[model samples]
Each structure stands twice: as structure tokens, then as C-alpha cells.
Target: MRQDKPELRNLSEPVRFKRALALLLMTLVLPGSAQIVAGSKKAGRYAWRVIAGLVAIVVFLVLLSLVWRSGTINLIVSPTTLRIVQVLLILLAVGWAALFVDAYRLGRPLTLERNHRLTASILDGVLVVLVMTVLIWSSTIVSAQRDFVASVFGNGEKSKADKGRYNVLLLGGDSGANRIGVRPDSLTLASIDAETGRTVLIGLPRNMAKVPFPAGTEMAKQFPNGFEWDGCGHDCYLNGVYTWAMGHKQHFPGVKEPGLVATQQAVEGLTGLKVNYYVLIDIAGFQHLLDAVGGITVDVGKKVPIGGIGGPIKGYIKPGKDQHLDGYHAMWFARSRAGASDYERMTRQKCVMTAMLNQLSPQKVLTKFQGIASASKEVVQTNIPSGELGTFTDLALDSKKLPVSSFSPVPPLIKTGDPDFELIRAKVAEAVGKSEALDKGSDDGDGKKSGTPSSVSPTKKPSTPGKTPSKPSTDVDDVAQVCKA
Candidate 1:
């Protein structure tokens, strides 16, 4: 009689119902979730490695879904999303830490019952899965950001035509803890012509001052000198203008207020040409990009001394025509400011860009694809629409079929008292051609007033050697006169 009493049913009626309900929900949820959670079983059993693999797979699937669904970038994680994700992760980690501490102290002998071990285990699993899901989503957001950033273009009209012709403003951002603010270490305009498949590069001197910016009160502070602009005196730093434009009212305006957009506008305003796009990359990222591209071969063209602003940073570039450069040294060459003018730096920047473009074969850096993409992701800000990336790639490929000749808008010619902005404006107009130039100025490079030309030659090369070569004269003009002219 003692042994034969039928074994009691395992669960009470209420408990049974609860368990059944939970099981039903799990069956609905966990098939999809567990598949994501379990991942594929591999040979290795390192816990961390397994977790990382699972995370990677999940992120990949999510991103692939976004790409597939949108066919272009339509989903962008707002700045708010990043903050929420970060805060949530940190809070979860803290809560888990507290639980771990409590378990260590109270659950003596690590028995299963007193602390409800099964319950704790379920909580841990659920939290981990939630964390993993969030992390995967976060990573998807980052990838989307990079792909979209690299694909956008600002030249509204140019983009509409589906031509390769685009404008890019390259800003070398100066970031530091104690500095007054971020400044553009370098500023340059890049023009890619789809029909001609030619790339025209122009560099702007950082110290060139008195450029127009919207005053803080005008037209809701349109730009140039609005609330977004943050520089002392009249004109803001070329790079600061971008920071102001994108997220002037807000600290981080996600990617919408990327400096490139404002730069495209400013360049358009100043130069009278529609900029197709813009790219802002930090010095560190630039170095990485250069290294990732196996460095670049540059023809120095003149003696480049490696020292700057009183020699705190030191390196030497010997006088030579062409030399191979690694990442570190190449940066020094491109950013060197010691015993040099902005014009010289501009020259170096163009050289680096040209060399990079010539050697920018995706095949060579396939192994470092992630690094390249990551570097671009962290540092670059642009307006290249994701939809146009394929078209851009095709255009770049087609460009290789044609010859690329390096050219610049003629340096403004000015009298001792007159500034050369109008002259510069004229050169800019000539650079983009009549139909493309935005602000057709009075001077057209030909010593005549209101003249227009297809292009301007800064110097004329002598056909014969040893004869006194004839060329345009560059008379010394005061900085003020040069700026205003």
C-alpha cells in the first residue's frame, strides 16, 4: 500500500496551466529567436568566440535584410537610438553585475533551490539574448551609416542627371580636448565630370579670410555666420562651417547635418558651382585609408621639408620628384605646415588624393575591407546617397579609360590694393565651364572685365628648353588685397 500509491501528477493544476501557457509563447517566439541564439555549432568551443560568431551572424542577417528591403538607405538610426542603445547596454551590464554579486554571497554551497536557480538561469538567458539582439541591431545601424555615407551626393542637380559628375568637399577635421574648437586642417573641392569622366581637384587655403557666412541673426542664420558657425572674428574656420551647418542647434544631429552638406552649399555660394557631394575625414582616418590603399606614390614636384609650427612634429621629406610613401609618412607630407603656405599644403593634398585615386583598386585591399570600411565609417561624413553608389562606381571605372589632367583655378591676379575674390570667382566659373559655373564673376582669366573662359592656365610651359620662358607674372600682393581681390 505504501509503495503502490499512484505517483502524484508532477505539476499542480494551476502550475500546469501556467507552464503550458509559457511553453506556447516560447514555441511561438523561440523558434525564430533560438535559431538566432543557437547559431551554427562549430568545432571551436571557446565561449567568447562562440558568442562573437553568433553576434556576427545575427548582425549580417539584419543588415542584409535592410539592404534587401530598402534597395537604398531608408533606415538610419537616429542619434537618439545610439544613446538609448548605449545606456541600455550599460544598465544591463550593471544589473547583471549586481545579480552576480548577490548570487555569490547568498547562494552558499551553490545549491539549486534556495535562490531559485532555474529562475535565475532563465533571467540570465533572457537578458543575454536581449543584449545580443540589441548589439546586433546596433551594428546593423553602423554598417548602414557607412554604406549610406559613402553613397550620398550633395550636388542636387548633378545627382538628378545620373551622371558621374559630382562635387566633394574634403575637410581634414581637427579634434582635440583642450583646443578652442574643431578646425579644418585642410579644405579642398573635388569635381568629377560624368560625361568627360574627368576629376578636377581644387584646394582652399585655410587662412583665406573674410569669406561670407550668414550672420547669427540673418535669415534664421542661413550659414557662413549663423549660430552654426563658430569662429572668432568675422569668418569661421572652413571646417567649423560644416559642424555648424549639420548640427548647429544640436550637438550630434545624427548624420543629417554632416559637414559635407554645408560645405557643398558654402562652396557653391563662394565658387559659383554646384557641388555634387562632400566628404569630411579626420587625419587619423585619412592615414588609415592611405595605408589601407598600400600608401600612394607621389611626385613631390618640389622640396618638402618635414617640420611645422615651430618643429613640435618633426620629419623630413627629401627634395625629389617622386617617392613611395607609407601611411605615417604620407600624412606628414600631406599635412606638413612648417615653412610652407596653405597653397603648398593644398598641392600635397591634391597629390595624395590623385595618387590614391590612381591606386584605388578594391581588389588590392580586399583583405582589409572591414578595416577600410570601419575607418571610413568612424571618420567620414558625407552626403553621397546610397542609391547612387553603383552609378558612381561605374563612373569611376569609366573614368579610367580617359586621361586625367591635373589643373587648378588660376590664383587671383590683383593689384596691390585690390583683393582677388572676384578674380578667384572668375577662375572658379572657368573651372566648371559656363553652364556649370554658379557665380559667374566679372573677370574671366583673360585680362578683360566680365570675361568668361572654359578654363584658366596658371602657368604656361615653354615648348623649347633653355630659352627664357614666358609666363603670367605673380606680383606680390598684401594678404588683405589678395583676399578681397
Candidate 2:
């Protein structure tokens, strides 16, 4: 009888192995399922309830987003909510890992044959890793959001859109150790239509001086005529406004970011457009961000010198049809002003922006998510509130489908040393009007006239009465065509 019992138990080894595999698979598919079927029913029930509750909460949030978009955004961006969620995610990860290990123990993996026991252990390890990985990732994202909101947003008064348009000031500059202070070398105002997402990039020269400030502001009072007030020297250029303001921060009482505030006021006064927000990009950090995204492809129309002007000359980005540039080269490509004019550099910068917008596809972003996120945090500093991110994200998606046009208030258009503010305003209005007209024509489906406005192309030449002349090219260009690699 004893010999028969030993044989029976040995014969059931295969059955035990099959049961263990089944429980592991069940746990993988549905947390706590395996324990309920073969392990501690109490522990399994608790875990299952938690899992179901989480799913329900997620569904609720989704429904809330659909019903109340703004409210949902505000709730999600709330700092308190983010911290709580982060803690919850960490707890969930620990709990899920424990449940996975408990499930393996409940399977009685130790009782199985040596091979089966090893297999079970490996499976259990994989399950724990996957579960913990997901939870940890979620926690990380929540923490990032919290940091982003805290760092970039302000409690100050928010500006409203004017005439259904939001004009955002995008400043690209350097704060290198070799440099003085924050000099906004590249200044552009992105004027976006609220309804259609139609956008126009208005580029201003860094050497532009005699910049005016909005009336009634402290800066305006000081520089009523222009920024060329007494005590200001050759450094009174538009780019130096930030540095000047920072040096005299006490002049602008109660202003937290005096330099940015002063710059925003100047932009508004210069373009005759209400500047809602400003985004400052550190040139060095910008290069890091480009590298994080695996570099970008651009069409280099000319040989651009790299590293010059006091610093040792590095090299040159040779002219090419489709040039792939790493961060260092791309930075120099957009910033190099040795042989090329700042206006030309502005065009190249726009091309870089367009290339990134078109080429950095969703798949690439996912693959380089962590690196991109880390670099972006270091690179971008904006006053745009986190609560408004969702709205802007949607707008960005809409803008992607539309054509991007640019206008440079340089040279023939407007003198940099002493700009005609009235003419500058008129030119800005004209450019915006042309963009709006094009959008309207497209919406109305006027096939013959639906194309981009001829006047918007800076390259277009005036047609003669007797014959049609070749269109002259201007600084303004179709971003897509210009960015083609």
C-alpha cells in the first residue's frame, strides 16, 4: 500500500505543474485571480477590489474629461492632486508586487519538480517586474507634471486673447558664462488665431533699438520716447532690454520677472499685439533637447560657420539638400552670424522649428520619452499656466494641419536701428490679415483663390502691366516647403 501511495503522488506531478502554470497566467491577466482560485481567498479578494476600484476611477476621470474638459484639466494640474496621485502610484506598485509574489507562493511552486519550480520562479519574477514597471512609470509622470507646474506657472494675472488671437512671445537666447546676461538674440511673436489655429511667425531683429514700451507702464515712463533714454549706451539694443531691466530691477516695483515683463511689454508695444505669454529657451539647453530627440534634419541652403566671434571657430555646416544635424551643429546652424545676416539666421531658425515639428513623429517621441522629458525640463521656461496645457495641446494639433507663414520686420520692411512703429504695426496687421484671408478662402473652398496669399510670400515680385514677372522671394515662406529635407 505504501509503495502504491508513493507512485500515485509521483504520477500527480504533471497535474501540479499544469495547475501552477494556469494560476500564473490567471494572475497575469487579472490581478488576484490566481490567489482566489488556489491561494489565500481573503488576500485575493482585497487585491481584486483595489484593481476594480482603480479601473472605475480611471473610467470616471475619462468621463469627467469628456464632460468638463477645463475642470478636468484644472483638477489634473492641481499640485495637491498630483502629489496624492504620486504617493498612490508608489503604494499601488508595492501592493501589486506583493500580490504577484503571494500568488506564486500560493501556487506551491516549491512542491513542483525542479524544472517546474525554476520555470514558475522565472514567470513570477517577470510578472512582478512588469507590474512594478508600469506603476513606477505612472508615478514618475505625475511627479514630472507637479514639477513642471511649480516651475513654469505663476499666480499673477493671466492675460486674455485680443481679437480672437493669442500672441505669444518666443525668445531664444544665451546665458553662457562668456556672455553678459540673458540676451534675447532671436525674438519672434507667434500670433495664433483662437478659432482656426492659423499662425503667423513675426520675427524681430535682435539689433532693433528704440523699442517702445506699452503706455502707462513703468518702463514706458522711463523710456517715453523709446528705450534710448539717457545713461543707455550702444547696449540699448532690443536684445539688451532683458539685461538692462535685470540690472535695474528696483525700477519695476512688485514685478517678479522684471526682465521678462519688460520684454513682453516691449513686444506688445512693438507689434501692436497683446502678448499673452512668453517662453524663454536657453540656447545651450535647446541643443541638449535636440540631441535628446536624436537630432533633426534640415536643408542648409548655405555654408554656415560654427563657433566664432571671440570664441575659436569650430567648423562649418556645409550646404546640403537634406542635412542631418546633431545638437551642436544645429545650434550653430541657427545661431551662426559670421558671414550671414541675423535675418538669414532667423529664417534658418524657423526652418529648424518646422523640421522638428514635421519630423519628430509620435513613434520617435515614445522611444526617446525619458531623455526628451529630462531635456525639456532643463530647456524650456514659460509663464504659460499648466492648467492651460490641454487647450494649447489641442490648438497645436489643429495648427499642424494649417500652413505656417512668417514675416520679418527687417531691412526693406522696417529699419532695425530706428523702426517706424506705425509701419511695423501696419505690416503686422497686413501679415495677419493675409493669413486670416487664406484661412477663410480655404474654409470657403474657393479653389482658385484658396491658395496661400501671393502677398504673404516675401519672395513674390510685383507683376508688370504688360507681362507677369517672376515672383520675388521674401523672408516669409511656407514652413513645410522650407523645412523639407
Candidate 3:
């Protein structure tokens, strides 16, 4: 009885085709959009597409602004990381657009089934949880980085100094189990004179004679109320002296004991300058820091020998006038005991430190954040507050053009026949800038008296004519006082 309406039937196919294409586009976009419902259900669903277009414009503007500003966003952070994050945001945006369209098209509920809303909600919640977790971790790392920077720049007496004036105590150690509680292998006092724009590094010999604590300190006076070292003939190691000097033993548990105080006093008496601050770095850290800044280039004076029982682990570093050294080989070369003298080691250390200074380029600074962080975190232990840390970082970053001079105390301060105490005092006074008649007592522009030993103190034992040299002083016992000063 009923005949098919040919016109109506013919129109259905093209309409279905259009709807299918639109649905496909919506599917592609809605997973990243917020849901929206309005207008004629079918026609209004396109509203999400319009919203997405607007969102795309906003994001474009933001990115353009970031590029224009040229901050860490443009220079420091990894481009690949930025790209991935951007892509995710784009995908999420697209997903939301699709979600919005689907919501609009579906009317009351956003699902194929009548009661599938709960499942959809669960999936959305899961996605949110994942996204938030990632954001949290990202935020934590970013904040940590910011905090580190802040620590370096914050204002405080400890951090206040002219742009060019600064001091750093450099400590080198074997860090081996046997070497534990022993003397540090190398010690250098580095000073940047703002007036002259020159850097001076004075390397100290490990066997320098000194007491661990001075007469007044309670610890020194109380030892056995102490017995004579002549009985044992055992000299305290340099590191032990530093430990006692800083009073680290009393404040930091397990570091306190008898011998440590003696070590502190010895270093003080030798240097004639109060030690303000120190940074202790081991062989591993030195190598890692070098690699972090890319390999360093050093001028090898001659073929440095390697390998021997008494020498630092053996290997031959070919003689060369100049060469690029990677971390591992560099360490071997720096700690090489081939010549077996502190002077030889000091020369190597200078070459390496100088090379490292030259290689600390801005390109590396921005690109090697992870490596730098790893290196610094592992090796650098200091009481310098976070605020002052930022200032020092800025200074170091700007110190590329500064002229640096390095010397071992042998010729002038530690000649073979020089009295041991005089050598120690001369070197300390030299490093403290008091030995220079002109610079004596002059304010370093910071209300405090110039050449005042920051906080380092030393004590020394009487020299035994023929016995092995006494151990260096330990300052760890006075650590809190020194740091506070």
C-alpha cells in the first residue's frame, strides 16, 4: 500500500556522509576539551571547534611571548622537553574539544549507553590523577632549582663582598677507605682580589707541621689532660686536624675525639691566617665536575709518569705541551705521583683547575644543568647558606675574564732550610694578604678589617728532628664557630 519516496531516500545518504565526517573530526578533537552543550544539538556541537580555535590562538600568543622574552624557557630548558610538553598540551586540548562536542551531541548524558556516565567519570579521574602527579614532580624539581639559585644570591654578611673579592678553600682527597681519617692529599687557598682583578692560589703541602688545637681551647688542654706524642711517634693526619679545627667533632657526632683537636691547632699555627671556609672534593667529584663542563684542556708540561705502589694508581699520560683530557685520565694526571712531590702535584692541580675555569662557558652552563647538579651534589659539602650561594654562583659565572695566578709555597715561603713555623706563618700571612705591607690593615671595603683570618685557626706540635713529619691540624672541632664567624 505504501510506495517509497525516492527524493527523501536519496537525500539520506549524503546527510549520513556529512554527519560521519563531522563525527570523525569531533572524535579527533574532543578528548582534550571541556564539555559544552547549547544551541541546536546537531549544529551547536560545532561550538567546541570554534572554542578550540580560540584556545589555539591564546596558546600561540603565549609561546610567542616566551620566545620574545628569551628566558630559561628559550635558552636553558631542553628544547625536546619543551616540545614534548607542548605536544601533550595540544593533544589534551584536542581531546577536550572532542569531549565538548560529544557532550553537546549526546544531549543529557555523554555516552552510548544509558548508564555509562560512571565509567566515563572514572576514566576522567584517572587521567587527572596521572597528569597531576607528573605536574607535582616537575614542580618539585623546578622549585629546587630556583631555591638553589636563591641561596647563592641572598643578602647576608657571610655573602657580602665586593664583586671581585672572594675566598675559597680547596681540598683534594684520595677518599679511599685507607685514606679515611687521614690527611687531605691537597689543600689550596684561592683568593680573588677585587682591587687588582687578580686571583691568587696558594697550594699548601700536606706534611706541613702544626698542632691540632691551640693552648686555650678546652679540648687541647684536656687530652690525658694529654700525654707526649714522643711515646707513640704517630703523627695525626691533615684531615683529622681540619676536623678538629672546625670543632666538627663536638657538634657533629662521631667526629669528636682526642687527636682531632691537635690537628686543628697545627693548621692554624702553620697558616698564620684564620681559615674562613673550605670545600672538600674527592677524585670522583673532580672528574664528574670536569665532564659536566665538557672535557678540560690543559698544557701538559712534560710526560707525567703514572703507576707505582706509592704513586696514585698507575697509567702513562703521554707527554704533551697541550692536550684535552677527559675526566678519568685527567684525574690520573692530576693526582699522578710519578714525580712524587707535593710541588709536582700542585702544578698539575693548577693546570686542571685553570682549565676547568676556562671551560665553564655559558653554553655549558645552560645545557649541563643535570650534569652540574649531579657533580655539585655529590662532591660539594659546605655550610654556606643558600642565599650567599647564589651570589657566589653569579660571581663565578662572571669570573671568566678574571686573571688567575697560582703558586706553590716552596720557593719563597717554604724553602728547604726555612724554619717550619716561619714557612707556615709566611704562607698563611701571604694568603691572608697581611704579608703585603701595603694591603695590611686596609678594609676590604666591607667594614671588617682586611686580612683578618676569616675563622681558620691552627695549632702545631714541636718538630722531632728525625721523625716523620707531624700530621696537619684538624679544624672540625671549631666548625660551628668558624661558620658562624
Candidate whose TM-score is highest: 2
RMSD, candidate 1, Å: 14.5
Ten residues in a row with the worst lDDT in model 3?
476-485
RMSD of 3: 13.2
lDDT of 3 by residue, 288-394 (tens): 87777777666554566665556453557775544777777787777776555656676567656766776777677666765676676666655444434434444
Q: How much does each candidate deviate from the true structure in C-alpha RMSD? A: 14.5, 5.6, 13.2
Residue range 247-352, candidate 2, lDDT tens digits: 8989988877688988988888898889988989988778898998989887776677888877777888887666899988988887887866777787777777
Evaluated at residue 405, the lDDT of candidate 2 is 76
> Scored by Cα lDDT, where does model 2 land?
0.76
Expressed as tens digits, the lDDT of each residue in 344-425 for candidate 1 is 5665666566667667775864455655666666666665655555556655665555433333432444331223556656
Where model 1 places Cα greater than 4 Å from the true spot, the runs are 1-164, 213-240, 243-261, 301-307, 405-419, 434-485
Question: Against the true structure, whose lDDT is highest?
Answer: 2
Ranking by lDDT: 2, 1, 3
Comparing 1 with 2 on lDDT, the higher-scoring candidate is: 2
Please say which candidate is ahead in lDDT: 2 or 3: 2
lDDT of each: 0.49, 0.76, 0.48
Backbone clashes in candidate 1 total 25
Off by over 4 Å in 2: 1-11, 61-74, 230-233, 361-367, 441-476
